[model samples]
Target: MTHQTLPTGSVSPEQAAREQSLVDEVVASFAGAESPRLRELMEALARHVHAFVRETRLTEEEWAAAIEFLTAVGHITDDKRQEFILLSDALGLSMQTITVNNEAVGAATEATVFGPFFVEGAPRIELGGDLAFGAKGQPCWVEGTVTDTEGRPLPGARIEVWEADEDGFYDVQYGDGRTAARAHLFTDDNGAYRFWAVTPTPYPIPHDGPVGQMLQAVGRSPMRASHLHFMVSAEGQRTLVTHIFVAGDDYLTHDSVFGVRDSLVRDFALQPAGTPTPDGRDLGDTEWTRTRFDIVLAPAQTASTS
Candidate 1:
């Protein structure tokens, strides 16, 4: 550990050349970490990030700016606002992490980022019921079935759905005591479920924060395409967290959170008035949109390994 001491506040050629070795020394120091996995991750992260810094010749000013940016992100975070998740989505790291954890084992639903807007305690609904109560949006009919990867029906599955109203506001966003757009329902014995909901509409990620400022600085849009969040689960099956996007949304290709997938997109078929209602909720001449998004889940055994 003994080494030649450079003069105070002075840099010599040999000392400058040894800067890279300091990174290696820090990486080796992580070997004594209590958790083997943690140690491994720290070592790998140190190596990769140190290489990035050296390769890019990152300046002190750039490092200071990064620290400031992350500090600002932290300052804006709260129970209702998840600035860290925003950061992950902005950099595409959230979707990339989801893609790594979820493999295409079969026709099962694809996983995506669990966006920050989801809230618990949504009211429960029957198989054929309306999810949007007092919500301001055009009526839409949504129905689907739950099945295993082999296509066997899974009855009694819990299907949780939530989305923004036509005004592009989630129930949690409104200060009023109203539960507009969110509910949970169970699949019937036939593995079929249906519910009336509002049409998904394009909305911006919660901006007005550091993340939003960064997006604007980079000339990027903050809009997420129209989509409904679904989290389905059944006994003996893996929980599936996903979203079904509107077929022709403008921001489909450029979702700010990068949660869109081709398989998850479905045509929101427009139904003209007088079409026989499935559950008979009695809507007068109002046209409605309909979509069927059957969900398939992998077995728990496979899910755990994945």
Candidate 2:
């Protein structure tokens, strides 16, 4: 194709420069137009997006496809799920953002992505109660304590936990009530907690969407290492959303979302069956897994201090 350059005299150099000035003026017009933080975010986003377009020499075709991909992502969202969040996970953006915002708070626990599968109002159960809801898998005895940075027990910390079954699928993902994998529990006076559940298995992220296409294009797998999600909170302490990843899982070093942290990796010890629970229920004759983890939280920082 033959290209036609702009006529030499069609526009003056000053006019071209003025066009660039208009771009800045348009963006600046939005500054101070809303909440201060929002204004700053908008301005920075605009600057970076514009810079990216220029730096990449983005073409109309590429831009149109990008828009279409985003539109499809929006279409895939619903009350119980968010496709954009999945996209963020697949691209490692969600984990990166969380890590950036969670700079260590004096030995406080690390925070990780609250993935797309979280549902509010999980059933509340006492420490050591079963979260398995009678599902079949490698029984796991999970025990832990909630404490402050100074090692003081947090008597009433609430710990919300969830994980996949032996087949690597959440309860909600496998139809209603097929499993009971989500539970909420509170720390006792000694800050001790425990629960019985199935040992989590490594699973693949949903790879039936645009995110999957992108992963395939890059020759990346969509699998996440075995892990259990925990959201723990207590009065006067900062809430922490994190995961206890199984150490030595094949996918740990190559977590699709980059959510693995050395501090979060834990050993799941295999225990012979007949392990007795304090409640006197024989943990059956099947082999099980056991793990113990502790959570330490930082004092809540006010918005100004944060």
By lDDT, the best candidate is 1
User: Model 1 Cα displacement at 147 (Å)?
Assistant: 0.4
**What residue pairs are clashing in model 1?**
none
In order of listing, the candidates' clash counts read 0, 0
lDDT digits (tens) for residues 1-306 of candidate 1: 222222234556675558656776888898789998898788878877876776666789999998999999999888768899899998899999888777777788899878876778999988778889888888899998999999999999999899999988988888786786899999999898999998899999978998999999999999999999999999999888999999999999999989999999999998888787777877889888999998999887765342
Task: Tell me each candidate's TM-score.
Answer: 0.91, 0.87
Worst 10 residues of 2 by lDDT: 1-10
How accurate locally is residue 63 in candidate 1, as Cα lDDT from 0 to 100? 99
RMSD of each: 4.7, 5.8
Estimate candidate 2's alpha-carbon lDDT, on a 0 to 1 scale. Answer: 0.81
Query: Which residue runs does candidate 1 get wrong by more than 4 Å?
Result: 1-19, 304-306
- The local distance difference test score of each candidate is 0.86, 0.81
Clashes of 1: 0
Which 10-residue window in model 1 sums to the lowest lDDT? 1-10
Clashing pairs in 2: none
